[model samples]
Target: MFDFIKTQVIGVTTPTVDFIPTAEDLPAFCARVSNPDNQKNFDTAAGLLKYCMRVGHWSVFDMSNIVIEIEAPRDIARQVLRHSSIKFQEFSQRYAVAQNFVIREARLQDTKNRQNSIDTENNYLQEAWKLKQEQVLNLVRENYQWALDSGIAKECARVILPEGNTMSYMYANGTVRQWITYLKVRDDLGVTQKEHVDLARKIKPAIIAHFPFLEELMEK
Candidate 1:
């Protein structure tokens, strides 16, 4: 059972943005200069909102930073490290002992989040998963000891380990914009982990405030 465990940020570096609106030019700027619905102001702020609603000049949102450390089964780690720009480093199961690994105590399993199995009634699923984890952990210990005594190489002996083995990882989100895009897609049905959706929902407000172009559409 993975709990509402804490995540430690390991590293992060994000790009800086300088927006030079494409709509700032004469005709296009005038076209979207007013909130057409809100009709009064003609300043940069209103024009910006109107333009963002129309042409979506959200280039300034490219700047922001985020980092997260996650623990998941090695089966899951294989898929999560695919995003190209994200910086990643994950634990190696074969080399590291499971006893050294951290187990998350989950109160509820959000199957919607990350497509993982969940526990809705009294956390039974989490408990079962924990017991399974303990069994696997014990297997690793027994095998490792047996291999050591039998003089077998550690690498060769660990090949039989199961995929449910735990691993921890650190990923840096280079741009908050990139993550916002990720949130929109991943938080939606069919693509989201319930926990991830919750996290994305939590992150949404701050992003909107920092990058107002992203704000209106999200609000709508």
Candidate 2:
């Protein structure tokens, strides 16, 4: 009955909302990129890279930041950290032994805020899900501890953890542009949660002030 693995969302992020680029600056920026003569005077490779980024042709969003604390399961965190450039800081459950860190999706589903659970609108788990999730977390934790006790390093013991083992992190500055892509990709399905949609809506307006033509296009 106990097939254990662990997972949870342990963080979410909010962007820093100030700092706007000037309107005149946007046109001049476009001009600088458009004119090879002007581009020639500056550092060639650096200038070209900046030019492509300004218009959102590629991942220029890495320049700005939006720090979110994601309550991600350990399994999810592993995937999340694959973006090598992004920064992350998580709470250490191994060190913080006193807190009641256990959380079940079932318990959160009954709460005033429904966010702690999955937004699976139609797939009602009833009872099987609760049991399944428990088994997963238990197995992951037990195996991890067992490996450590048996002479394996804690680091090596964590290999069996699943995507649901939750953790927290601050995806610091230079993440906003990637977030624009995040908004676009996640929004298409109409299945994204309202909280994220609202965040994208808010940040886009601010970002547009720095990039008017972009504002004109995206806002339309």
Best by lDDT: 1
For all candidates, the clash counts are 10, 33
- lDDT of each model, Cα atoms only? 0.51, 0.45
Q: Model 1, which residues run further than 4 Å from truth? A: 8-55, 63-67, 92-119, 122-129, 145-161, 195-220
Model 1 lDDT per residue over 87-167, tens place: 676665456544444444444545566555453566676688678777777877787678767977666766766654544
TM-score of every model?
Answer: 0.53, 0.43
Cα lDDT of model 2 by residue, 1-220, tens digit: 1112222222223223232133323233334555746633323433444456556556443444445545434443454455555566666544432111233343224265444334443435536676686677777777776777798765566556553434433333335456456546434324443333443455455555544445544643
Residue 21 error, candidate 1, Å: 20
